[model samples]
Structure formats: structure tokens, C-alpha cells
Target: MAGKLNILFITADQWRGECLSALGHEMVKTPHLDALAADGVLFKRHYANAVPCGPSRASLHTGMYLQNHRSGTNGTPLDARHTNWAKEAAKLGYDPVLFGYTDTSQDPREEDPESPWLLTYEGPLPGIRPVAMMGTWPTPWTDWLKANGYEVPADIRYAYGERAPGPEYEDGAAVPRPLIYPKEADDTSFLTDRVIDYIAESDKPFIAHLSILRPHPPFVAAEPFNAMYDPEAVPGFKRKTTHDEEAAQHPWLEHQLGRKLFRAPAVEKKLRRMKAVYYGLMSEVDEALGKVFAFLKESGRWDDTLIVFTSDHGEQMGDHWLLGKCGYFDASYRIPLIVRDPRKEADTARGTEIDLFTENVDIMPTMLDLIGAEIPVQCDGASLRPFLEGRAPATWRREAHWEYDFRDPADDSAEKRLNLTLHQCTMNIIRDEKFKYVHFTKLPPLLFDLEKDPDEFTNVANDPAYLPVVLDYAQRLLSWRMNHDEQTLTHISLTEDGPVTRRAARY
Candidate 1:
């Protein structure tokens, strides 16, 4: 509303929406993010439209659903034809820098089939300039460590956790120990330092996407962070007492609960320890981010920067006997979103909390709208510019919709085990304030009364008393799908004068 604003988009991988201290979480403390919310507006009900980094970031970057983008799995490539925020920002003469991994699978059609990029899902997104890129291997950070006299492990994952010297568990899940690296050398710290250094060198209005991987796997924290919380004092999990109890609820849950990698720790104490470490990791990230906030303010860029903080998706962290982000659970999809616009016009809405059902797709459009850039017609999300300007849109969504395409194209392990076709391995969820409805491609549907059972321990889909609610939600899901189906070419037509395009003129 005043000057050309610099965009700082930060994402924390696998961070749950409820973990923010500003949002009144009991255990975790995020003082920096709390300060951010105090200076900005927070969307309390933002959800990711897809899961497992690749599919979710595909929607986040392209502003399209999994159905429209078709990048269903981690190794799946995003179609090259689609336009992304990075490409659009590049059109406006910005480099659109990326400080961390985007989890984008390279489009095979544009490269050699044997190209190294095709081998992993950690490839950089199409148009962004990589100021620094850290992935599962994290060559950049590892190299930095090596240069600084730190021993680099062949498998970088070992640096995150230690396995006990004793015999492993029956399921082969090793005991997770605290990180071997120092607090300053942690991944979150390294990335934040890199971003601060990059911002220092830039004089132009820039768009930087910082993707942080913390409070995510390995369940390890460094130094005081590892000792920040007591495992015994951690909040209790909102899951069934045992895995079998969860599995008995649905066929999908049974299959999901059987996966060793996603299963919660068998020992209750060990599970609570994992949760304590997770909260510590979150606290570490918050501390690391505090440096960024300090840098922005010290450099006098705070007033001209639009800061956005959110996660790609959320982790279950023992919720429903699950550890990773997947299935139809709210813990897997709900993510925190905070936007701080420092323009004088946005002062009225600063420190405000908007209670609207928002999704990851809305992010791209919101950025474009703020920068006065043209929003692509292909985006399924609407901009939140009105909210930042202290006005509600005439019409806003009342429900949050998310989809998880669970097909493993390489192994097809799920297909054979679950007796499902690759095409039938998907699930979609529609959740309103009061109720949530989960529909699988080829499995039994699930209905949860959020008001009565927030933990979602009970599925009331088959209850005669709730039949009307289920039917209504089912129809709403159908209507949502019909309304959001792909329309890339729908607005274009060949008229008597020539070809006419409704949205093409803006670009």
C-alpha cells in the first residue's frame, strides 16, 4: 500500500498448527513467532492441500490441487507448462531466491531421462535462484561443517540422531539420541545464517523462500534445546491406547498403522521423549528465526518487508499412532500461517487473528496480489489481500479441503498389500468448523464430529443419527470438487474476431 515490499516467505517442514505458543500451546514455546503474530495477522485454521513434501509443495508453489497439478508422490514431476509464483516474480525482474529445498521433482520431458535431477524429489523448483539449497543430504551445510573442522558423516542422517550401542528393537526402530552437532551448527541455524547473509547483499526488492527442515524427522535437538523440556512432563497424546485400537477403526488405518516407519514408539516413555525432542526442535527453529527478525529490523527493512511464516504440512507426532504426515487426520494437514504486512494501511489488522478456513494454495495468490502482480487463472486459491487491508472478502470459504495421493509409483507396496490399484490409492478430506468428512478412493468413508470428538477417535459415518450430517458433507464435498475442477482452457474460446481469453489479458 506504500512502497515496493520485499517478500520473505518462510516454511517449516512437518510443523503442526497447534505447536505455536502464540496460539496458546501448553508445552512448546516460540517467542519469535509469538512476536511475529503480535506484529501481524495469524490464520488459525490454515491447512495444506496435499502431503509428503513433494505433493504439498507442488500445490503451494503452483497454487493448484494434487488433482490439477498431478504431482501425486515425492518423485513425481510438476508439469512444466504450469506457471508458479517464482516464474511470475522473475517476470517482474526479481531473481526470486530460494535459501532451502523446494522438494520439487524435475520435469522429465525437459531433461535427459538419466539426468541426476530426475533421481530425487529434492530438485529445485523451475525458476527460483538457489542462494543456498539444503536437502536430505545437505551438501551445502555438510561442506560448511567440513570446512569448519567438523567430521562429516557419509550418511548425514547420523548427525541428527544416535543409535544405542545395544541391540535394536524388534521392529528395527533404533533409539533416537540428541544431535551430535553444536547448537550453532544445527541445520536450522545454518539456514537462518545463510538467509541473513543473503539479505545483507541484496539492495533490490526481493522475494526469498526459506524452507526450514526442523521438528521434522530424526527427533533430535542440540545443546540446551535437547534439555529444554522434561519427557515425563510432555502433554499426553490424543491417540488410542494401542495401535490395534486405531487399526480396528478403518481398513486404511489398519494399513497405515502397520507401516513400521510411521508407527509410534511402543514404549510410552520413549514416545513422550520423542515428543519432547520435537518441541525442542521447534524451539530451536524459533531461536534461529529470531536472528532473521533481528536482521530485518536492524537493517531498516522491517517496514518494507512482507513476512509470511507457515509449514508445507504437519506431522502427526504420535497422534492416532502415527508419526509422519499422511492419511485423513487433522494433525497431518492443519498448518500454521502468519502474515505480517508493515504498510501503514495494514495497521488496523496488525496483531489480528482471522478465523477463516485457509489452504496452502491461497499463499501464491496472496503474494501476487500484494506485489500487484497478475494472479494466474489456473490457481484454485483466492488472495487474502482484503484481510491484510482490514476488510473481509464478500465471500470466503467456510471449509478447508485437502487431498492425499498415497500411490508409491516405484514399488507399489501399498497397491499389492492393500489390494488397491495405483489410481485407487488416494483420499480427500473436507472439514468444516463442526464436522469433518474423509472419503477414500476405494475404502470406507469416515465422518468425525469435531465438536464432540476433537481427537477423532470415533468414526460416526455409519451411525443412523448422523446420517443427515454425513450426507450433507458428502454433497458439499462433491460440490467443492465440481467447483474447483481444472479450467485452464475453459476461459479461452475462438470467437468470430479471433481467439479470446478472459484471464490472459492481465498477464
Candidate 2:
């Protein structure tokens, strides 16, 4: 803690919180991440505040809730006035380099009308330096593939799915086919290589954001990883017996199931195969991370670095008959969070798993606090420094909160389908130890007694017995919102003598 801490912030896309081997998961294997957790404090109940990449990363970077940031959807622009961790870190003499994507949609008011960044939501964060940019197109990885004598696809987006020359399935069941590129040439490997090279070459204390794209899409793994997990052995989903039965729980669930993009494959084998490959991709990323961890240790920078490993959001992975990250299920919002603080003060808490409720908004404050920077007043989350030092705050949050906005501005698809206006196409979740209450802006509410039905199969919102519980949780959600509403300038006022100000106490 004497000198500035070097920060290695990593995120694997669409990873489930329960998939880590250290968590005693039955199917997936994440040995490298497990090792990191063994040396760090693992947060068992951490969650993302929003769904999809743009809004969730907005919350993660700015330390604000979705309601405060207002970057509701994938293409929604983040307000340019807001200060992010990257910008704050830069003020303290850190370069704040990015090795992969942030999924930020640049504010149009700050850009030219002819700018190409305006067309894509994959714009870099305002203050960060994107050294190896890999967004939706992934030109850097694809270019590496072509340079290595591998045939690149005509459309670069299909690079991840370019399969090797072989039949896709064994017998009649679907199997995850291997991609043409080897594990060394994979996107995850490319990002890892970039991070290692940058860290090795940097002379100053480095701050690098390694955002890896894996376990996210295309669901295909390279060579050995594709065959790592057996489709038959993977665990069954947490959904009801049939899709229709799952849809009957709520109208929002029904609408999501009706969409082809979110619906799980009808074929049982196909769904199982995708799940297997998803696990495989996670292991592959873990392997790539092993190299980075080893490099840090071997270079003698391990003890001075503060490593934060997490995901922007969680993947449903066919839970509740859905395949993507959205809706009210815990599978879509809950994500893994491991913080390895290589200081003597953190030794007592190493390998300890804390069950306190944490959210993506807390990430920014944690990083800012560790680096000796003043956390912005706009941050809705409290820092995890106390937890890292083996002490819990006197008063901590008992529940996790998240929001999902399904508005499609370009087409208004959700609005037309759900009979809601753009502002009404939103849902907020309040989940505690034994119950979860989902409040939609204009739609019906959903309450689940988690202790009785852990899988969230039944809705008790309208059951007369649970009406009081529903009202209580609704009030709690409103109180939480009102308390955490944007406070950037609310604490400042002009007095007759001078301007008076008070800092917002995050905890």
C-alpha cells in the first residue's frame, strides 16, 4: 500500500457466477480463476445492475445505476458529462489502457455527424486508450488469424465460428464442432497476449482493462476445448418441464420466449450441446488467464498489482427456457467477482468468500478507492475496501438490485409486442435472501418466494397470501431508488458567505 497499485481489470463476457470450479460447480472448470479466488476475496452474491453490454458496462465503469446513467439499451449513448473510473484514474497519472472493448455508445452531442463511432455502440470509453480494439468486428483478432496462415471469413464476424473440416455431430446428437483456428490463435489468446506485452513493456505503474470476449456468442470453442465437456453430462436447466409452462409464469416471460433470438433451441440435445460449449469457452478463457497470472508473478509485479476479475453480465444458458441475458431470473443478473489485493492488509481475507450483496456499480468505487482517488459523487455503489481488509461495514445492503430495459428505439419491437411505450418497456428487480420482487414500469409485478421455489417456477404476486410481502418489497424498491437517485450536485448549495458542499457517503 506504499506505492500506487497497478490495476489489472479483466472481464469475460457472458459468464455465469456459479460456473467457477472453486464454487463446487459440477460441470464447468475454471482452474485459473479458482486460483485467483484462492488468493483474493470472492464475492458470492455479486450482480450486474443491467442487462446487455452497453447499459451494464455503463454501470460498471461509472459506478452508477442504470436509472442514473440512463444508457438503457445497447445503442443508447452515455451522457458525456459523467466521469468514469478511466477518466478519474487518468487524473492520478495512470494511462488507463484498454486491451479490448467497453461496449460504450459514444454521445452524439460530443462527436461529429459523420463519425463512424456514431454508427456502432462499440466505441471506447471517453478517457481510455484502446490499444488492441476488439469490438463487434474484431478486426485485430481476425487480422492475426489471417497473418498466421489461417483463412479468414469474408465477413469478419463469422471468424469465431469458422469450423474445422469435419462433420459437426457424432451419431444423431449435436456436438460442439471445433473452430478452424487453434487455441493459440483464438480471440481470448490475442487479448491476453496484448495485455502481457503492454504490461511487460510499460515502465510506469500500469492500469490495464483486459476485456475478453468469450463464452459470449457463437458458442464454438477451439480444438481440445470443444471436446472438453460431454453434452450428456452437463447439468439440466432450471426451467419448467416445457417452454409453454415456463412462459405461463408472466406476460414478459411469454413475450421473451416467443422471440427467436432469446428462445432456447427446441431440441434437447442442441441446448445441451450449447451449454457444454459455453463451459468449454469459459475454461479456454481461464487457460488464457493462467498465462497472464503467471507472467505477472514471474515479472515480480504480482505483489504490487490489484487484480479484479468479473463479468459485465451473466448468461441465461437456457435457464427459464431463455438463452440470453435478460428478464428477472438470477441467472441473467448474477455474475462472478474476485478481487486479489496483493497487500499485507488483505492476507487475512484471502480465500474467504463473502456472501454480502454486491453489484456492478461497486466496481468503480472499489478501484478508485484503492488507487487513492476520490470516488465521484455520482457513484451509487460503495467501495469493497472494508471487505478486502477482512471487515464488513456496520450496515450493508441485504439485497441485490438490477434493471433491464428492452426498448428498441430504431424499431420499437418490444413496445409493439408488449403494448407499452418506450419509457414503459423496463423492469427492475429487488432480490434478497428469501424473496425476489420484479416491478415493471407499466406491466404486472412478479414476486417469488425463493426459499420455497428456488428455481422461480411459480409467481406468488397475485396470491392473496403474498400481497403484503409484494407491497413491502415494492416500497423497498422505491425507497432504494429515491435514496440512490443521482446526487452529483444535490449535496452542493450556494450560501450567502460562500459555496457549501458535502460529499455523498456511499456506504
Which stretch of 10 consecutive residues in model 1 shows the poorest summed lDDT? 167-176
Q: Clashing residue pairs in candidate 1, if any?
A: none
Cα-based lDDT at residue 226, candidate 1? 74
lDDT of 2 by residue, 47-92 (tens): 9999999999999999999999999999999999999999999988
User: In model 2, what is the error at residue 160, expressed in angstroms?
Assistant: 1.4
In terms of lDDT, which candidate is strongest?
2
Report, for all candidates in order, the number of backbone clashes.
0, 0
Candidate 2 Cα deviation (angstroms), residue 339: 0.4
Candidate 1 Cα deviation (angstroms), residue 25: 0.6
lDDT of 1 by residue, 353-460 (tens): 989899999999999888888889889998888888899888888899999888887768888878899999998899988999998888889999999998899999
171, model 1: CA deviation in Å?
17
**What is the TM-score of each predicted model, taking all chains together?**
0.95, 0.98
The root-mean-square deviation over C-alpha atoms between each candidate and the true structure, in angstroms, is 3.1, 1.4
Clashing pairs for predicted structure model 2, backbone only? none
TM-score of 2: 0.98
